[model samples]
Target: MKQPLLRYPKALVLLFTVLACLSLRTVTAQEIRIVTEELPPYNMTLNGQLTGMSTEVVQAVLKEIGVQASIQSMPWARAYDIALNAENVLIYSILRTPQRELLFKWVGPVAPTHWHLFAKPGSQIQLNSLDDARQYQTATVKQDAGEQYLQSKGFTVGKNLQPSNKYTYNYEKLKSGRVDLWIANELNALYLVRQAGDDPTETLVSALSLPDLGGDNGQNMAFSLKTPDALVERFRQGLQAIRSDGRYAAIAQKWL
Candidate 1:
């Protein structure tokens, strides 16, 4: 019994050391989930590849920081929800509105978004101001900034504010006279119309400019509040690195 005691202690120590190392590795390798939506010219899937202005900027930052994370594209509502509630989840091409200021950690003016209420070509909808749009039905994507902005202004869903799952669906709804207007980013509206095989100028017209939604604040890369501050700073510095190196400008020039 006394002779066996020495060997048993040695075996237990080796097992404990191995377990500690494995635990450390797991803790250090936390997953960073990146989520986005198919808002064209910003974030989209082309030929099954995730590429766009915001997507490129985000990818460049990840490379600058020597981090690798797959970007998943989904409906805006679902992506927003995951980023809202999940730990270490990152959302991009998002407008940093006052309503969302404290909800997450921030990075970048990845790009600016010009929000507008669009109408059918030659339609008699004239907007003297944002309030003028109240009487008409406007198509909006679910959980999008435009929809939220409208809701805050008393636009009711299933009434004057018609919410859909996709921006393209709103475009179709506008064209078919199902909705009097479509609220969307100007560049996105044009790209979507072009994708649908129509000239944007001929397909839709800007009815009103909603500057408050994203006029000057610009879009940003955001992380859930629970993500480490040090991790967020790494991304922030990486983003600045790209900007200083002209990679940010190159990506913007390519897509914008």
Candidate 2:
């Protein structure tokens, strides 16, 4: 009877174990690595600082989860590869395509976007279908979402006209007749045309109807395939928290 009086409840021990596991979870959640391409209005560096709608939204989510993230900006292919093969890595604001579905664990719609086809102002390229521009040499940022979409469908790419790196150069190529078509996000296409000192109206001709290109509007925050499922769950929860709290909309409005 005296020994029984000193016994600790089994329930208490289980509760203690659960609490310890949660503490460990919190500690492990702090490390998140984000790899991104310079897709402006989404993820990009401004004035030597990370600033953009997608970047802001991600930061907000990480803050809520008490997580620390390092965002690496690189070529689209490079970023995708990192998120695919590297540990604790993720890629941002990417269009969710079928071909890319099994590569990583995804989180987001931090924002929505539409793809646009850009051509020189004088060009009479009508977009009755994606095939309409088949005759013209389409240029795209190498390994970009747009490029991947068209290339997957057997469209012959003209040259690697990387955009986020330098839109002015691509614009010049378009003007000089080096590239017949350029695929870009609608908002970004407009921004680049204006930035290049070209009449957004007279220099770049966008297709009347933007195409879906088979992806979610904004892109998902993707965790490397090799990441632990538990960690992926935490990231997914973090993203949901932002969306549910309306923080996602607030940050997205800053860019859109």
Question: Top TM-score: which candidate number?
Answer: 1
Question: Could you tell me every candidate's TM-score relative to the true structure?
Answer: 0.88, 0.83
Per-residue error at 222 for model 1, in Å? Answer: 0.2
Evaluate model 1: give its TM-score.
0.88
- Model 1 segments beyond 4 Å from truth? 1-29
- lDDT by residue (tens digit), candidate 2, 1-256: 3455237588678888798768646645565578787777677677888878878877887788777767788877777777878777767877787777787787656667777778887677777777776777666776667877777777754333334334445667777888777787777677767766777888877754455653345566777887767677776888899888888878766776
Clashes of each: 0, 1
Error of 1 at 252 (Å): 0.8
Model 1: lDDT of residue 207: 87
